[model samples]
Target: MLLCFVDESDQGDFHGFAGLMADEHATKAITDSLNRTMRQVAVDWGIPATTELHGHPIFHNKEDWKHVPTRVRVGVFHKVFEAIVAEDVVILLRWVHVTRLAERQARNFYPVNFPPEQVCFQHILQRAQQVSATRDTYTLIIADDRHDRDRHRERFATYQTEGTPGVYMQTNLDRLLDTVHFAPSHMSRMLQAADMLAFIYRRVHTVTESDPRASREMAKLWNTLVDSGRVHNEGNWP
Candidate 1:
């Protein structure tokens, strides 16, 4: 079985859906490695050892991130990225620029009621099925719990039963397991990694347009995932 840990970044101008897919056998090792890296980074930075690693704060300079020195902050970020890349994992992402989506809706080119979250989930489900097919294994999606947990769960159930409409040519219901699981970010290191991936990709595409240094740093990480042939993107809608 393959376990896919999913998370999203909906801040600022871009929204991103990303997940880390790893074999069930390797999941523990990957998460442990991530935990170790995070703990070590905290120790090195002289922060509380129990502090949780959150991508938004670390990348966007919020919360605990503001307390850490710039070099330490960047170091932790790179270390976490390296930990995931070193493991046997596949990163999956679907990003959308909200402004462009809104513009498309305003022009009647896209459905007004079809929110970016829905589009992102549909793409993730499709990708999960594809990954499951190639691996000849079943996939269980474990996503970061959100305020809209009930709604998201209901949607997943609907998709499992009815299949996704107006998105894929045909509904894929075989490879993915019926139920979607949710967990808090701090509870799962894999989820933390997923959060980082989504946040980094969204930040790179949305917020760094004019900042060359920021763009270079973000793009370097983003491109590494892109070159791995495991990450996928669903471009903006018409």
Candidate 2:
């Protein structure tokens, strides 16, 4: 049985990337740290980091994605994910479309077109069910902007009762496995890691840019940091 959690981030959406892009260096630094942390985790577990795991796609502009090589561009996703999760570990990935959610009155206050990546909640829900059907797995998904009271109220009122879109995923997974629990995303380290991983994944897998490259460079840098004993534990980072 694997106790896993999943979250998503979309670089293509304004709400998702606007603030991050406001300070390019800050965005790069945090993402760099993410890459670093994941690699260290792999190293601590005695796994070798490879280019196969390093190269990620990063789209500076969402509009450009339609022009990128879909096949090759999508390949980076496989590479990044292959490195993040071990073969024996069953990963539960949650998806939600932030743009669509924002269109609704309750969530409209949030930035739109932030990242189309977060919008794939229904897809992630289906994938989770499929994975759980064959293996013992558990995952909690967090939608961006879900931290607000209205979102929670909707979850309890509509989702919990009538079985709404991202809300009813638990029931769908229950048909396949015994355990399914949904919680706010900000609450879990595993989900936070998943979000960071997903963000790095977008940077490395979507477009060719220096920022994505920074993710790999940061991974190498962190390797040196760990070797130097600068970071003694996990809770020290953003």
Residue lDDT tens for model 2, 49-142 = 3211222222221332334454433443433343333223333323333445556624545443433432344344445444545445443333
**Winner by lDDT:** 1
Model 1, span 130-182: residue lDDT tens: 87787788888899998888888887878778877665535655787867888
Show model 2 residue runs off by greater than 4 Å.
Answer: 14-84, 92-119, 136-146, 149-171, 175-188, 211-238
Instruction: Give all TM-scores, in the order shown.
Output: 0.87, 0.39
- Which window of 10 residues has the lowest lDDT sum in candidate 1? 229-238
- Candidate 1: Cα lDDT at 42: 73
- For model 2 the TM-score comes to 0.39
Q: How many backbone clashes does candidate 2 have?
A: 24
Please give the CA lDDT of all the candidate structures.
Answer: 0.75, 0.37
> Over 4 Å off in model 1, which ranges?
99-112, 167-169, 209-212
